[model samples]
Target chain A: MIRLENVTKVYEGGTIAANDVSLDIPKGEFMFLVGPSGSGKSTLIRLMLRDEPVTRGKIWVAGKDITTLPKWKIPYLRRSVGTVFQDYKLLPNKTVAENVGFALEVLGRPRSVIAPQVAQVLELVGLADKAKRYPRQLSGGEQQRVSVARAFVNRPPIMLCDEPTGNLDPKTSVGIMRLLDRINRTGTTIVMATHDHAIVDAMQRRVIALDEGKVMRDDALGTYEGLGEEE
Target chain B: MSRILFLIREAFVSLRRNLLIVAGAILAVFISLTLAFGALVVNEILRINTLAWQQGVHVIAFLNDAGENGVPSNAHEVLLEDVRGWDEVDQARYVSKAEAWIEYQELFAGQEELLDIDPTILPASIRIELVDIALHNSVKFRLDQQTQVVRQVTTAADSIEQLQNLSRVLNVLGLGLAVALGLSAIVLIANTIRLAIYARREEVAIMKLVGASNWFIRVPVLLEGMIEGVAGATLAVFTVWLGSTSLARAGEGFALFRLDVGQDWFLSWGLLFLAFGAVAGIVGSLMGLSRYLRDADGTGPDTPAGF
Candidate 1:
């Protein structure tokens, strides 16, 4: 679960990324953040991750206030929250299994423990047979799947997705969305920021719309466009 | 622990992957440390030679002449006893005409032309070794005050001073060169670590996101830099030892009595160089990591460089 109390983020050039945003996201809920570019969606995700300090107010993730957390504690916070980027930030030199295993390995997990977990995650992502292949050898969809496996390998309580399917084809994006939906059904909270109107409308999930660094709408079971809009 | 082993393995793999850059860093350390080792050896050699010259005959007072039967006169013997009794004089040996002749021959053994002179023509002198080279002036004054049986008083003070001054300048020059070169070695190491960091920036970013501590990312790079330093220091020590002994043997003591830096002396200096190389490697790593680590820690610009 996550809570933001009037969180505000202002960049160096007098540009406000998030303006007095307040929201509550419960556990096991799938939410889509629909907005145009520079609409504070990515900034909100960053604040939750503690990537940058909140310029104002506080943020609570997984029942802890993170706005005042020290920089040294940021990594520990990241361990409990999985993140997937649009670019599938995989190490090009690493194999699919190693990429998945990296999440556990970096946290100082034992090799014996990591091997089985990596295998299970790869199977979940339907890439068990391609474990030995490097990132460049995988297709766009498969690469994103590998990234998804990496993020989900540790099975954190919450997953933050920032345009994960932005680069994938529509059919592949649906498959990836389905995988995320399965993850969310397993009682893991997911907050996906995206511009994919079709996917957002199809999911029929809770939706928050932002414009000009402020939340414009919050709807339960909302369409890609808000409830007041004419399709 | 397995974690330490894992870090060390990472370091080794990185070094192997960047073989050329690692070698470059090692070579930098090697060249700098070699010069530093050579400077230390040269300083020791100079100290030994200077001490020998100062401790050798600091003053020589010549007697009036030889007796009719190739023996120093009794008055000359009395003068020798007087000089020996002086507090400034450590030991005054009465060199007879025959002893002087023999010393002259030994000094120029291979020079047949210089040894062709008559034995009696060599001056019979009193060779005075002083407790300190500075006491030479007092002894010279005492000899000069006496007119009997003292033809001339020659003090080796000026030549000793010259040698001391030359040694001081050479010591400073060698050490200065070593220091400048040592700094260059540190900079080269810093650059090498920077390149290594650049090559793995993406991996570093992922590692940070996955909750890897800052040290988990830093220690392996630090070890890699340190290994380069140690490797260079090893080569420097071996080369310095080899070069020193070879030069000493080649010179055949080089017309000096104090080419006598022993193995123990060289070993101690070599150990110092090794320690210095390790410290320098660490300093270079710190220098290289400062900017990147700061950026990674969220203290930099709007865009995060990497963790």
Candidate 2:
């Protein structure tokens, strides 16, 4: 459902972020993107999110050439791909329920639909009891769960997690990974970018490793490779 | 229905959370509208007073006596008849020398010593009222040409001219002050809205990421600014009304100045002030939202969106 045909991204002043990298993931597939800092992993995710344009390649997500999509239609394209961030990205002033309901609200869904949908998603993420609490009032794991609930609230076809558990403890990271796996098993594609070896080793899913703005390895049920200690 | 209500509820919640900024916006609108309303009231009073003076204007033409100028008494009568027949003249009454002197004596009745002078020394004057006070110059020119009967023409034209000049100067000064105050108010309101938006920047950013439409984000901020503006304007109008009423009451006996703060003026000014409030609110919201939208589009946080 996602394809990058020799996609290249170059920042201003001639800095190449991703150099002629190409990849493909079939529908309902689960994949991990592994790389060190400044290794172009984030750039790949940003390109997928349409936050930045590709320099000299085409990106097709859910069978639409997003490279040729009009600016006004970018938001609608984003509605089909849910994104979770490392910081949880929950609005600090809003309650857990508000943060989760925000995604549905953006879709202009009626309250009757939003309320039940948000309730169900929050329940799935085990954050139903903390719905009334603000982000500052919740722990890191709980806040991450709220973010997960928000990302999945609209039932997007694909979920992109950019270091979703980077700030959590190992046990909490495992829990988030398990939640993601549960979501993946329900027939939705999942693509995560991270450098965590333990989690990648535990998942035993397809992995794509990048080094110096180039894709170094791609394997099904692969192990973390080509990154030394202090990554 | 519930979604709209939820949006409104969220807007109010955000407003309450950012009360200090909202208060600042209200204060800016209040001060600006107060100055504007006060100027409007003063302008209205000046206009009414000018109209009254214009309507009450009369010209008095003094006739040359037959003993001094060797003009026949019949010449003076014929001149009076000619002046009376002018189309511009609304009404004319001939004042005999004795009658003019008697009127002067009555005016200075408290000073009996000055009233002993000869009444015959006063000149016979013809008082003329013009149908239109603005045609004073034309009537004056016509009377000045008749030197055989009229020695000199005196009119309220000079006084009216001076008053008009003063009113024009006052209007320019008021406009300058209003413009300066309006700019200051815009700056103050923009700052207030900026602060409110800054406080909620995280929520705004999240909304953008979630694909919220521009209107969904802008409407709340606009409503907040509008509420503050309307409240401030209403208070300002009330204050000005009370001030005008009190001033009119205090000056009733003294007659230093008179103001007609009647229902019409109140209604008109009140509506104008309300409109000012709405404009201030809309401007503030636009300023705030422009920056927010720009930042959401991946530019610097303070970049303004092109409207």
Candidate 3:
């Protein structure tokens, strides 16, 4: 339930991050944005979150035009759209439970409400036993799981990820993909930008490739790179 | 409300996390405010003593005994009666030749040559008290011009004038010093808050990303600044009180000036200092939060490193 029509993002130093790009994804679709560096993959995610303003186009998420949304309304936009980063941006000092519960806490949810939701998400991500452990105390995969739990704690309908498994081993990446797949099975839409060919090929989900700020390919059940494109 | 309690708890948690930085901020406020309050107290001390001295004698006019300006020998009595009727004059009395001679002998009893001088040589003075001490110059000029009824005049006006000038200068300089120091303390506090925020920047980034409002992030940091400021103010007020009390106690044996200002005066100022401390802390917190809040909007320095 996200639509971007002729959206473009231009940086100050004359770098066009997203150049007249357009896309539409129906509800409950798990899609991968496959692109090389500087191909506007992250820019698409940022524009969806309204973290960066679109230079010349409209973006609608969940039937509302987010490009016209005021600055103060951006937080509410973010609440409906969960975000995850490659580095697993968890507060190092907080335990896994606190980090996960932080999602609801920022929403001004009461402790009674936040506690159960955080526990459920941690269980879903398979980190139920390590709730008390700090981020540094957990492995790379565990830390990424904690980040995933934080993103999913509020039970948002849409999850946007920028390389969710970039820093993890292949086996860890599989675990993360399985967790994402489980979440997707619950009818939540997921758009992930990635550089991982093996992961994308194995999942065989919808793939959209971009190059030089323009969409190159959009396919259902697509591989990371079609048989001929080597790089 | 639970909201307020949550903010307070969060603020205290941050202060505890950065104990060293918090201490530095409080110490800065303390030192600056101490100097500020100290200057105010010193100026007040001088004012109280000046009031005590001014109450003693307003103006004393020494009359001529020779009557050289066509004045009668009995002019001392006439001058005293005339001064008593003047609007400026509060009370006036004639000191006769015999009284003047006796006062002369009591003053020079240890001097052989001064004791042998003739009694008529000493002037029979008409001591004139004024309605207000500030009217000294007007009365002095009037008496000095009274050549027909009086020959000469003397007053304690010069000393009082000097003291008033000194107090005026001190008032300006003291306040200037206080304002400058207060500003520096504000800057120091802003820097301290910045340091605290920097240490927890990742937490801030996570909070922003997870849909925390900017105000939600700002409340606790503002509270921390306020705590540090109030702590500094308490130390400053106590130190000023101790200093003034000790100075007043030491001046007990010295009868020339009264050092103790009543507690009411100090009590009000102490409360004011505390309020000032709280405001300064808030101002500093706002200053420190400017960049951080701007960054939280989107692409800040703390943005996560990623693809």
Candidate 4:
């Protein structure tokens, strides 16, 4: 579960990335964050990850007030919430398996513990056969799958995806979404920021839309709307 | 323990990734430390030689041969007494004409021609030795004031003084040069580590996102720098040891003093240089990595293309 109340993020030189945004999602919800460019979608994800500090208001993640969390404990906060980026963020030099196992490795998990968990997640993302392939050797979809596998490797209670399928083709995007949906079925809460309308409309999950910096709509089983205004 | 291995392996990988820069860093450390240690060793050797020379003949103030009884007069004895009473004079012995004759006869025993010469020509003098060699000038100046009895002051004190001054200058300049070179090496190493980290920026970012402790990401880089430092220092110590050993052996070929220093002295310096190298490497890497660690915006791609 995650909760944000009246959170605001302002960048240097007075650029308001997020303004007066608040939301709450219960456990095991697969929600899509839909928005136009510069609409605070990614900002919201960053706040949840504590990558960017909230300028105003509070944020609570998994029953802990993360906004007040000390800097030393930021890593602990991140360990509890897995993040998947749009670009896949895989090391080009590492093989798919190493990339996935990296999450557990950072957690100081032993190789004996990391090996089986990495294999299971890679199997779940359908990249079991390509575990040895480097990021450059993999397709766009495969790279994204590696990213997903890495995020789910530690089996965190929550996952944040910032446009997980932004760089993939429609068919590939669909596969990535299905992988996320499968992960969600395991009762892991997922909050994804995306602009893929086709996938958004098809999945019909909860959607939170933002505009300029404020939350515009929060609908269960919502449809993709350009401005997210009720007609 | 496994994590430590992972960190070490990662460090080596980083070092290999930027081999040229790392080599340059090591070379910088080597050259600077070599110069520093060589200068310090040379300074120590010169100081030892000066002290040896200072111990034997400090100051010799000759009395006028025109004194009555072809020996020292009351003025000569007075000068000797004045020289001996001074705090700087550790021991002052008056070698009378008779003693000088005996000493001269002993000095030229095999040379009949020099032995036939007059004993009166050998001036009775006060041989003044100082407690501290540095006070030689003051002692000589005070002795020279007795011009009526004192004929001339024979001392290599001026030469020794000049050598001491040169040694002091050499020490200051050598230490200054060493410090400057050491600092430049530190900067070069820090830059090299910075480049290495930048090359793996994305990986670091990913690590940060996964809740990796900053130390987990940084320890390997620090280790990389330390390894380079230790390796360079080892090479430098070996070079200095080889050079000193050769120089000491060569010193045996000549009649001059030996170049050999105490084994403990050499070992202590070697250890100090090694410790310095290790500390410099760790510090430089830490300084370089500090910028990245302080960044709260994880190193991930911040390109807000969409969403």
Candidate 5:
């Protein structure tokens, strides 16, 4: 579950990133955030992750007030909410297995647990055979899948994907989205931010639209609204 | 404990992958430590030689002429007895005018013609040896106050004073050179670490996003620094030992130049160099991580969703 109460964010000098927005999503629900570039969609996700502090409000993730959590506790908070970025952010020097195992290693997990858990996650992401391959050795779709494997390897309660498919072709994007859908189906709450109208309309998931730092709509099973009259 | 092992494993892997940077850092530490330890050995040798010279020499006192407040014949016997009574005085002998002339003649034997002068014209004197030549100045000062029996006192004071000044100057110069080399070593190490860090900046940012603690991120860099430092220091100690031993053996053939590198000195300096190398490595890691850690904490411009 996630909640935001009258949150606003301002960047250097007086540029508004997010302005006076509030929303809530229940546990185990999948949601899509749709907006154009610079529309505060990324800002909303950043605030939830505590990557940037809200200039003037409170944020709660998984029933804990992250806004008031100490800096030392930020790492523990992040362990419960997995995040994937537009860039896969995989270490080019590391193999697929090493990349996935890295998340658990940061958590100081035991070797006995880490070895088997990493193998299971890699297999779940359909990369069981590519575990030994480096990121550069894989295709863009496969790299994104590795990133997804890394994010979900620890089985966090919530997953946030910020334009994860932004760098791939349309076909690869579809494959990545399907992988995310499969992940969501297993009962981990998923929130993805994107500008892709076609994927949004096709998935027919709950949508939250933003325009100019304010939330414009929150619709269940919503279409990609405000996109040139829905084509 | 397992976390530490994991960190150490990662650090080893990273160091192996970046072998050239590690080598460069090691080389820097080695050269700096070698220069520093070499100077230290040179200083120790100078100190020992100076001590030997001070211990080998005795003081020489010159007496005033007869009628110029000259010492009485009986007073001369009393002065000699008093000098012999002191515990520090190993031997005291009276040098009459005739004996002084004979000693001067023997000293300048090449000029035999000058030795025929009347011995009675030479002044009376006393030759005194102390248990240790370092007490020469104190003995001279104590006897000079006896104006009734002694007029002027002179020992190897000027030579000893000059040696002391030279030692002080050499030490200061060595220290200045060591400090300059140390700073250069730090810069070299910092640059090496920066390049290594830059190569893995993406991985570091990902780790930050995944909730890795600052210590978790720092351990690898610090380990890398330690490895370089230890390797370099070992090399330096080996080189110093080899060089000193070779020089000492070579000096055996030329007895005029005695090069004595004692075992205690070698062991102590070797340990000192190793410690210095470790400190240098840690300093370099700290310098490189300062900027990177600040950026990763979200205080810098690029907040990559992880900080």
Candidate 6:
């Protein structure tokens, strides 16, 4: 459901963030983006979200050619793709339910419709009892679960995860990974950018490795270190 | 409609989140609008006093003691008749020397030494109240041209003119002060809204990422500004009404002029102030949002790192 044909993003000072990148992900596939810092992984996700304009080439997300899309329509593009951040961006003042319901609220859903959907998502994240608690009152793992609940609330066709488990501990990271895996199994394509080598090596998903603004490897079922590597 | 309610709720929540800034905005609106309302009342009072002054005898044409026949001769009668027929004259009353003498005695009733003065020295005159104060000079010139019967034509026109000039100056000064205060209020409101938006930057980012309409985010800020403005304006109107009512009830106690600003006048002006406050609040919030929250293309700002 995602396609990029030679998309290049150059920064203000001529720093090439993503150069001549061409890739495609079929529907319902789970992919891992393994890279070091400044490896164009975040830039690729941003391009898909239309957060930044591409310098050249085309991008199609959910059947729309977003590269030539007007600025006003960027919000529509974003609505079709769910995003989970590394830091679990939840409003500290909002309860866990409020945080999850925020997605539907922004969609202008009626109160009667939003309440049940929010409750269902909170239950899915196993935070039904913690719905009334604030972000600061929740553990880091629980906070990330709230973030996952929010991203999955609308059940969009694709999910873009940018180091969602970057701040979580190993055990918590595995739980988040499992939760994302379960979400992916429901026919939602997931593209997650990460530096977690152990999680990537264990999952053995379709891996796309990037280094210095270019894709270095594309493996159908690859570990974090890529295929044919000694353990 | 429910979406609008949601936006309004968000606005209140944001307002509660930054209570100090909201209070600052409300206070600014109140102070500025109060000054404006006071200036309006003062201007209205000046106008009323000027009208009252204009309603009195504005010009007096004194008859010469050595007229053609006698004191009430043909010359004096003709002059009086001509003045009464003039379009400018609303009413003209002939004051005889005897009547003038009696009036002088009543004016200085406590002064025994001034009562001994001869009554013949007091000239008989026709006191004229004009239809309009602007015709003072023209009416005076008409009497002066009748030099045979009219000895001197005196008028309070110069004093009236000076008072009118003072009123104009005061009006200009009040307008200038009101405009300056209004601009400052706008600036203060913008600052307050800026703080509010900054505090909710994370929420704004999330809303943007979730594909919420720009207006959905902006309406709350705009409503917050308008709320402050309307609240301030209401307080100002109430304060002015209270002060005016008290002054009118204590009428004539302090040897001052009448408090003639009626309730209808106050009501109209109060409505105007409220409308101005609401407009100012909306503009201030829009400015603040444009400056800090939205980009040049009217898109939301870059999402900050939020957790």
Model 4 iRMS (Å) reads 3.1
Writing each residue's lDDT as its tens digit, candidate 1 over B43-162 gives 888888887787788898887675644444587877878888888878988888889998898899999999899887777888999987877788898898866667789988889989
B114-211 in candidate 2: lDDT tens per residue? 88888877899888878877778899899889877788998997787788889888878777776676666666777788877887777787777777
Quick one: best TM-score, which candidate?
A: 1
Model 5 per-residue lDDT at B145:
84
> All models, DockQ values?
0.45, 0.35, 0.43, 0.43, 0.41, 0.43
**Model 1: residues with Cα > 4 Å off, grouped in runs:** A226-231, B66-72, B108-116, B257-261, B303-307
The global C-alpha lDDT for each of the candidates, from Candidate 1 onward, is 0.84, 0.82, 0.84, 0.83, 0.82, 0.83
Indicate which candidate wins on DockQ: 1
lDDT of 5 by residue, B84-108 (tens): 8987788777787778887898788
Q: What is the lDDT of residue B230 in candidate 3?
A: 92
lDDT winner between candidates 4 and 5: 4
The sequence of per-residue lDDT tens digits that candidate 5 reaches over residues A1-231 is 999999988886666778898989888888998887777888888889877777888999999998888877878888888898888989888999989998899999988898899899988878999999999999988999999999999999899999898889999999888988888888899999888888898899999988768889999999786643311
Worst lDDT 10-window in candidate 2 chain B:
B298-307
Docking model 5 quality class: acceptable
Which of 1 and 3 is the better model by DockQ? 1
Estimate, for each residue in A1-231, the C-alpha lDDT of model 1 and write its tens digit.
999999888887778888999999999999988788777788888788887788899899999999888878888899899999888989787789988987887777888889999999999999999999999999999999998999899999999998889899999999999999999998999999988888999999999998767889999998777433311
* Per-model TM against the reference: 0.92, 0.88, 0.88, 0.85, 0.85, 0.91
Candidate 4 Cα deviation (angstroms), residue A45: 0.8
Residues B1-307 of candidate 6 have per-residue lDDT tens digits of 7688888997788778878888888888888878877777777888888777777789998988654445455666777788899999999999888899999999899999999888899988899999888899999988888777788999998898898899889889878877787777788778777777777777777777767767767898899999998988898889878887887778757434767588899988889888888988998888888654455222334332110
lDDT of 4 at A114: 87
Q: State each model's C-alpha RMSD to the native.
A: 3.2, 4.0, 3.7, 4.8, 4.7, 3.3
lDDT of 2 by residue, A61-148 (tens): 9999988887677678777888888889888888999889988887878888998999899999998888899999989999999988
